[model samples]
Target: MARTVTPEIVAHVKRFEGCKLFAYPDPGSVNGEPWTIGYGHTSDSFLKVRKGMTITQAQADAALEHDLNEVADAVERLVKVHLTDNQFGALVSFAFNVGNKAFANSSLLKKLNAGNYDAVPAELARWNKNDGKVMKGLTNRRAAEAGLWAKGSFVASNTVEAAPGNPIKDLTKPETITAAGGLLSGAAALATGSPAIQIAVGICLVVAVGVIAFLVIRKATR
Candidate 1:
């Protein structure tokens, strides 16, 4: 059976890759390296990415889906053992970040296929260096990926907690207030017996709340 990459996996990859609608060179390069666009899709023989190329959010999303499918296919082809959804997702995200070729040749894959599961995390962490130097972002990403692989869930550790002197008491900011209003409005509409309208409104409100909360937390940490 061919395993499918779940939506959760797609979300995880997107969170790390981020959305760059316009083409930009890799950051660590002195000269403009491979141009990347639309959720870390780099220019290759298969796709021609140019300097001024820009895409809409929908187009970017489509590109991400296509790229992720390719990575998922590669993961399915390479791994020998059965995997959980989270483990599959972690590998997909890793392969997406570090190219399919590197993933195929990695010690992580070797150990995973050889049934040395206990050694996988250390093997995954060994690839945290960029240009032969360790990067903090890469270190965190590897840890998260390894955690997902081992535990079969994404554990969020990115949030900034309250310090000794300062406290973060008010989570009901304007955006959250708007989200609450939306939730209430959806509930009211549901009470009116419009099932379709209520479902749509509820989904929109939930998405809104999620987006608002993510933005607020991200901004606070920064």
Candidate 2:
């Protein structure tokens, strides 16, 4: 819990593999509006703020980032209080999608408190509905969250906290590695159930093979 919240976490959460971070009316404009909340950027939606709120995009972005930091902090606290590492990450991922309240009232929370790990996966599936509809996005998120949540137990030492002697250490700054790693992990999770990931991975594999072949041919000529 010594790691503080940093811009890393903000960027990680704000990162949209196939979604837009801004609010607009057209799906073609930004990978479609979010399944639950349509309008504005993903970041704006995350903060539950309205577009055209009299702030510059930059200012609005800052506010949204700050709100995410707040959410992350809240997640850390909840993790400390009850959930395990995987559970914490899962909850964060869930919050990133369904917003915080869903996690707050989630049966996952209840099950976790009762030390019922087996119940988490099922509870996660129940969160896939929005406004009386079964949204595909929510379904994907729930599955990803279930996977992440199943990772391990609560290990607060992995959390960012202040130095024992340094009270000035801010809790709002996420560590660089944690932020970057979390973003990459999120991408991996999204990619697992998304065609986009397969496409990207294929592209990368192809590029790697090409580079290796080029190197091999050059060595033979030498």
Candidate 3:
């Protein structure tokens, strides 16, 4: 399968690039040119980003999705070597942080393409510096990238599994939805006095039914 960024890599990037609802000056920007928002995204990543602009949580998430896709596409286009999902994710995160141009021109890319795969982690580590100075955050990020490069592939990110005998469970699970829906329906049946309460209960029942149907469809497709 073609390699792509995994949720592990997304979580890694998000750990460092915190979300900001309001646009703020890019601290790493030497010239104060681009304002940033929503998990290190700038106007280049999302055109709507500008000074004095605010965004909803959904918009921020959308911007992150857009930016990650752009970076992943760029990584796929530029790199010639075959990469595992983890490797691709690591490079995508690096490229997203350092920009495509820098990544394209870096020795890491050169060494990677030339078949010196062992040099990847070291070369990636060398990129810890920003504007000739080493930033602690950058150092930490590079270390994480190095680890990612070395680590091999694992299971798919969206695989939702519950541990044995766990009390807390995922709400989307079929059993959970069925149980919740049964309780809601019983409560609705018992509340014969208030029409308003029944309406609310009806809405809840509809939502629960929709959830159960969705789970069934998802399972069948899988």
Candidate ranking under TM-score, highest first, comes to 3, 1, 2
Q: Please write out the lDDT profile of model 1 over residues 14-77, one tens digit for every residue.
A: 8777898898997754578778888987776556788888988887887888888898999999
Candidate structures ordered by lDDT, highest first: 3, 1, 2
Instruction: Give the Å error, residue 213, model 3.
Output: 54
Computed on alpha carbons, the lDDT of every model, listed in order, comes to: 0.80, 0.56, 0.81
For model 3, residues 1-222, the per-residue Cα lDDT tens digits are 335567788788888778999988898775665888888888862556778989988888788888898989989988999888888888998999899999999999999999887888888888888779998998899889888887874434357753333223444667876787677769767678588887787787778767766666665455
Model 3 misses residue 34 by how many Å? 1.2
> 1 or 3: which has the higher TM-score?
3
- Comparing 2 with 3 on TM-score, the higher-scoring candidate is 3
* Model 3 segments more than 4 A misplaced: 1-3, 44-46, 153-222
Of the pair 1 and 2, which is ahead by TM-score? 1
lDDT of 3 at 199: 78
Q: List the candidates' TM-scores in order.
A: 0.64, 0.45, 0.64
